[model samples]
Target chain A: MALSADESSRLGELLTSRAEQVTQQWTEIIAGQLRGRLSQAELVRQVQELHRAMVDALGKGTVDLNGEEATELRAVLAEFSRGQARQGFSATETATGVFALKEALLAVLEVDQSIETLRDYVAFSTLIDQMGLFTFESFVRTRESLIADQAEQLLELSTPVVKLWEGVVAVPLVGTLDSARAQVVMERLLQTLVDTGSPYAIIDITGVPAVDTQVAQHILKTVVAARLMGADCIISGIRPQIAQTIVALGIEFGDIATKASLADALRHVLRLTGVETARRQPRREA
Target chain B: MERVPILKIGDILLVSIQVDMSDQTAVALQEDLAERIVETGCHGVIIDITALDIVDSFVGRMLSTIASISRVLDAETVVVGMRPAVAITLVELGLSLNGIRTALNVERGMELIAIERADEPYDERDDGPIPEPTASP
Candidate 1:
C-alpha cells in the first residue's frame, strides 16, 4: 500500500532520529549473512548510503518506490546488487542484505508498542520488501549480461584460423560443433582464405569428439563455402570411430579430401603444391 | 549504365568488375566480353570480382552465360577473387556457378588458364601404346 503523507513524515522522522543505530544494526545483520566475504567497513558504507537515500525519499513524502524522490534510492539499491553479483554472491544472499533492514527497523519499532507504531512498521516493511525485489531484479540482470559476454568471448576463443603453411591455413576445432560455432568457424576460415589468399585450408577436427550428421553437415557447408571462394578445404583428423560413424551414416564427403591427420593433410597439400620433401635415409656404409 | 572495362593481358582477357551489377550493365558486360574475346582471339578469360560486394542470381546467371559463350568461342573462363560473404550467400542460395572454373586470385587464375592451355596439345595426342598391325593373310 502507498504511504500516506502523515506516515511518510513519521517514518522519515523516525529514521532520521535513530539513523546511526539503524545503519549500524543493518550493516551488522548484512555482515553476519555475508560471513566476512565482504569487509566490515565496506558493508557499513553501503548500508549507510542506502539508509540515507531511503530517508531522503521519505522526507519528500514519496508514496511509491517509482516516485521521482525515490530515484536516488533506486540507484543506490541497483549499484549495491550489481556489486554483490560481481563479487560472486548468490541471489538469496544479495537480497538478504536488503531484507536485513527490515529486521533492523523491527528492532527499533519494538520499543514502541502503540497500535499506530505497529501500522507504520507494516507500511515500512512493505517498502523495504519492494526495495529487496528491485535489488533482486538488477542482480539477475547483471548476472545475465555477464553470462552473455562470457559466451561471446568463448565463441571467439574457440574458433581460431591459424596459418599452418605458406599457402595453407588450419582451423583446429577442439570442442563440440554446434550450429553457431560452426557458422563462426566457416566465416572466419573463409575470410582468412580471402585475406591471406591461401588456396588451401585444412579443417583439423581432431579436437571434435564426435561426428554426428549435423556436425558433418556444418563441416560440409564450410568446405563448400571455402570452395566457392576458390579455396580447397581438406577435412583432417578423422578418428577411427568417427570414420565408421560417417560411413554408417551414409554421409558422403564426395571429392573433398579427407586425411587421417593434420600431418598427412599438410603433406598432401605440399605435394599438390609441388614442394617435394626428401625423406631422410641412413647411410648403409660406415 | 557503367561499362565494365575488359583488359587484354597477353592471351587472357581480364575483367575486373568493380561496380554493382544491374541487369543492363551485366548484359553490356556479356556483350563486351564476347566481342573482346573474338577480336583478340584470347585463349583464356579471367573475371575478377574482388570489388563486387554482392552477386545475386542475375549476376550468377550472367557469369554462367559468359562462360558458356567463351567456351563456344574456344576460350576458357576462370572466375576469381569472390568475397567470402558472397560465396556463403551463393552457397546458401544453391548457386554453384556450374560449368565455370574458379581460382583463389588473379595470379592463380592465370596459372590455371596457362596449365589448361599447356595441357591441350598433350591431351590431343594419343599417349597410349599403339597396337601392332594385324598380319592377316
Candidate 2:
C-alpha cells in the first residue's frame, strides 16, 4: 500500500526511536551479563540469546507515531544513545566477548541509520564502526603483548626470523620447551621457511628440557607448513616425554621426518640425496 | 680484553661486551663472549659481532651454542651485528641460528632484556645466587 507523506515521515521517526532503544538495551544487557561473571561458554550463549530477544522485540515493521509522538521518539532515542555512550567497559576479545557486544550495539545502531536519510546513516554507522574498530585494535594489541611477554620469559631464545630457508635451515634447540616458547619456535620455524628460499629445515630439539603434545604439535605444524610451501622439513628433537604425549593426546605426526639429533638428521639428508658428508671418512680398505 | 661493569635491570642481568669479530680473532672472540656470560652471572647475554667482515660456521655455531647454554642458566641470549652479506651466507649455508635470540645491536637486546625483567614480583630481592646452567648430555 502506498503511504501518504505524513505516514512516511512518521515511519522514519518510529524506526529511529526503536533503533536507539535497542542500542541502549544492548549496552545494558552486556553490562548486566558481564557483572554476573559467567564462564566464557555461558557468557557467549547468553549474549547470543540476548541479541535474539532484542531483535524479536523490535519487530520488522514501522511503529506508527503521530507528529507529536515523532518529536518525543527522537528525544527518547537521543537520551538512549547518550546513556549507551556514557557507559561501557573495555571489551575483551579473548572469547570474542567484545566482538559480541560490538555486534549487538551495531545491530541496533543500524536501525536508527536505516530510518534516517541514506547518506546521513552511512556516515553515522561508519563513524561508530571506526571508533569500535579502534577499540578492538587496541584490545588485540594488548593481547599480543601479554603473549609475547610470556614468550620472552620461557623460550630464552631469540629473533623474529626474516624468512624461512627454502633448501635446509638447521635450528638446534636446547632447554625446556614450554608452551609459550614452543609457539615462538613453531612460528619462527614456519615463517623462516615461508620467507627464505630453502626447501628443507631441521628443527633439532635435542636440547629441549621437556615437551608434551602441545610442543610436539608445534613441531608437527612447522613440518606441515613447510610441505605446504613445497619444502621437506625435518624435526630432530624427540624427547621421551614428547613421544609419550603424542600417544597420550593421540596426536599423529606421521608425516614429519623425525630424527634423533641434528647431526643425525643432516647425515640422513646426505644419505638420501647421495651426497657424502664432509666429515664422513672414505670406506677403510681391508 | 675490554671489560664493562654488569648492570642489573630489574631481574635481568645485562653486561655490555666488546668483541672484535675480525677474521683472525672471531674464534677467540666467541670464546671471550661465552666466558663473560659464564663469569658475569647475567641472565641475558648480548655479544657484539659488529666488528667483523666475514663470519664462518665456527663463529656461527659458537653464537648458537652460547644462546643455548644461557637458556640453561635461565638467561635469554641475543647475537647481533653481522654484515648483511654474512647474514645471507649464514642463511644459505643452512646454519640457522634458529631458536636462538638475535638483536640488531646491544641496545635493542638490553631493551628486550628490560622487558623480560619487568615482570618479576616487585619488591622481591633480585639478590639471589646466580643460576647455574644445566648440564647437557
Candidate 3:
C-alpha cells in the first residue's frame, strides 16, 4: 500500500540514513556476525543475483529458479561451505544474520509504512504514486527539502579540517566537485576559516565534475566569503570543462589562484609567503 | 531532465536514470546527489540506466566522482542498469573509480553491499545462473 506523504518522507529519511551507515562507511562493529553460515558461495551468488535483479528488475526476462537453478545453487553451496567470508570480514556477514537482516529490513519497511500520515514533501508523495519515478531521482529532487530539515541531517560533507601552517588554514576539495556540494564546501570552508582566524584558504576542485555557471558561482562565493572573514581563498583544480564554464559565465575570480591540482594549489598557497619549497602530501578523496 | 526514485531497499538508494541528462544537468545531478547522499544518509547510491541511451563522459565522471565523495561523506555509490555499451566506454576510458563500486544492475550492487554487510566471504561457489524472476504478466 502507499504511505502518506509525511510518513513516507520520514520513513524514507530513516531508511536512507540507516542504509548509508551500514553500506557507505566501513563499520568495525559488524565484523563478527559472519562467522558461520549455512553456505557462503550460495549467499554471495544470491547477492550477485539480487544486484542483477536491480538492473532490468521488472524488464529483464525471468525464468523460474524453482527448476534447475535452485538445484544448482544447492549443489554449489554444498561444494563451497568451508568459510563464511573471504580472507577476512566474517563477523558481519553471518548467513543467519543475512536472513535475519532481510527479514528485519522487510519489517522495517513495514513499520515505516505505518507512519505515513504527516506530509513532509508533496513532491515525494507524487513520486511514490508514479511507480518507476520514485527511486534515486526522488532523492535528487527532494534533496533541497531534506537539507532544509537540518545541516548534517542530509548528507555528510567533509569534516572541515582547519590546518594551521604559518598562520594559514587550507581546505582542499578533491573528487568530482559539483554545484550543490561546492555550495556546501564553500559554506563550511569559509566558516572554518573565520572560526580559525586563518588568512588563507585554498579550495582545490581538480576532482570536481564539469565546471558550470553554478560551480563558478560557488567558487566566487567561497572567495568572497573568505574575504569577508579577512582571509584569502585560492581556487585550484579547475578542469577544462570548468574553465570553459567560468569563461562562459563571465565571472572572474579576482586575485583567486587557479591551479591544475591540489599539489599545484599548495605550491601556490605556500609561495604566497615566499616559502614555495614547503611541501607536504595533500590528502584527496579517492 | 526528470528524476525518479525507483525503490529504496534499505540503505541502497535506487534511482531511475534520466533518459536524457544534459552536460549541465549531469554535473548538477552530481552536485544534487552529493547533497542527497549527505542528507538521506543512505549507505549506497544506485543509478539505474536501462532507460538511458547515451551518457557522455561528463555524466560518467560526475557519477564516479560523486560516488567517491559520497562514500567519504558516509555513503557508498553504485551505478546500476548500465547498458553494455556504456559499460564498455567506462572500462575503455580506464576511469579512476578507485573505491567506487558498480554492478551490472542495481540489485547486484545492493546484493554486494548487503552481502558485504553480512560479511559473506569470498565464496568461489558459483550459484550457477539465477533464473530471471518472471515479471508479473
Candidate 4:
C-alpha cells in the first residue's frame, strides 16, 4: 500500500527524531531472530544504514519503493539481502530483518494512542512489508545466480582432456553425460588433438554409473567429431553392466573400437603406432 | 578467384588451403587438384585445412568430391589438419565428409599415405603376440 503524504512525513519525522532508539531496537530484534549467528556490531551497522535510507526516502515523500527518491533505500535493502544470501541466511531471516523496523516503530508509536496513530501505524507497517518482500526477492536472485555459477564451474571441471601419452589423450568422464557436457567433451577432446597432434584418444567411462541411449548417442557424436579432426577415439572402461545396457538399448558404436579398459585401449593404440611393448624378464638370483 | 596452391612433396601433392573457400574457389581447387594429380602422377593427395576456421556444408561436400576424384585417378586423398571447431560444426551439421580419409596433420597424413601405398607388402608379423618371459632357473 502506498503511504499517504501526511503519514510519510510524520513517520519520517518520528524516525529522524528517535533514530538511535529505533535502530537499536531493530538491531536487537533481528539479533534475537538470528540467535547470535551474526555479530552484533555488523548487525547494528546494517540496521543503522537501513534506518537512514528509510528516513531519507520517507522525508522525500516517496509513496512507493519504486520512486526515484527511494532509490537509495532500494539499494541498501538489496545490498543487505545479497549479503544475507551469500552468508547462507534463510529468506525468512533476511525478510524479518527488514520487518523488524515495524516493531521498532510500533514501540515509538505506543506512547500516542489515537485513531490517527493506529492508521499511521498500519500505513507504516505496509511500507515495511513492501521492503521485506523486496529483500526476499533480491535474496532469491542472489542464490540462483550463485547456483548457476557453480554449475558452470562444475561443467568446466568435469570435462578435462588430459594427455596420456605422446600422441594419445584421454577424457575420463566421471558423471552422467548430458547434451551440454557431451558438447564440451567433444570440443575439448578435438582441441587437444589439434594442439598436441594426438592421433589417438581414449574416452574412459569407468566412473560413469550408467549409459542410456541418449548417452550413447552423445558418446558416438564425440567420437565421430574427433575422427573428423583426424584423431581415432577408443571407447574404454565399459563395465559389465554398462556393456549389457548398451546391447539391450540397441546402441551400436559402429566400428569405433571399444575396449574393456583404458589399458587395453592404450595397448591397441600403441600397437597401431607400431610401438611394441614386451613383458620384461626377471633377473636370475646370484 | 584465389587458387589454392598445390605443392608436390615427394610422391604426395600437398594442397594447403590458406584462403577461404568460396564456391568458385572450391570448384577451382577441385579442378586444379585433379589436373595436378594426373600431370604429376602422384599416388597420394593431402589437403591441409589447418588455417580454415569454418567448414560449412559446401566445403565439406567439396572435400568429399575431391576425394572421390583423386580415388578415381588412382590417388589416395587424405584431408589433414581439420580444426576441432570445424570438425564439431561439421558433425553438428550432420556432414561426416564421407569418402575422405583424414589424418591429424600433414606429417601423419604422409605417413598414412605411405602405409596405404605399401599395404600389400607391409608385414603384420611384428605386431603379432609377444612371447611370454621365461622363468629364471
- Candidate scoring better on lDDT of 2 and 4: 4
lDDT: worst 10-residue window of model 1 chain B: B120-129
Residue A124, candidate 1: alpha-carbon lDDT: 85
Per-model TM against the reference: 0.91, 0.29, 0.30, 0.91
By DockQ, the candidates rank as 4, 1, 2, 3
Q: All candidates' lDDT scores?
A: 0.91, 0.53, 0.52, 0.90
lDDT of 3 by residue, A1-286 (tens): 3434344335445444555332222122223343543345544454444223322221221122223323443333322222333223233243332233333334334444434322333333332223222222323334444456555543255535458476466665655456566666766665555355455677767656566666666666656544422356677667787777778878777776777776676677777756746468899999
Instruction: Return the DockQ of model 2.
Output: 0.01
* B8-126 per-residue lDDT for model 2 (tens digits): 55444444444534444544554555565567666677655656556677666666766776777667776654344455455446565666665445555566566666776762345
Candidate 4: misplaced stretches above 4 Å? Answer: A278-286, B20-27, B122-137
What value does the TM-score of chain B take for model 1? 0.86
Q: Which ten residues in a row are the worst by lDDT in model 3 chain B?
A: B83-92
Isolated chain A TM-score, each model: 0.95, 0.38, 0.41, 0.95
Residue by residue across B2-113, what tens digits does model 1's lDDT show? 9999999988999999998988998899899889988988989999999988998988898999999999998999999998899889888888888888888999899989
lDDT ranking from best candidate downward: 1, 4, 2, 3
- Taken in order, the candidates have interface RMSDs of 0.9, 11.3, 19.3, 0.7
Show where candidate 3 strays beyond 4 Å. Answer: A1-154, A157-159, A162-164, A175-180, A276-286, B1-137
Question: Model 2: runs farther than 4 Å from truth?
Answer: A1-166, A175-180, A278-286, B1-137
Give model 4's DockQ, 2 decimals. 0.68
Question: Scoring each candidate complex against the real one, what DockQ results?
Answer: 0.61, 0.01, 0.01, 0.68
Q: What is residue A272's positional error in candidate 3, in angstroms? A: 2.4
Q: Can you tell me which runs of candidate 1 are displaced by over 4 Å?
A: A279-286, B22-24, B122-137
Write down the DockQ of candidate 1. 0.61
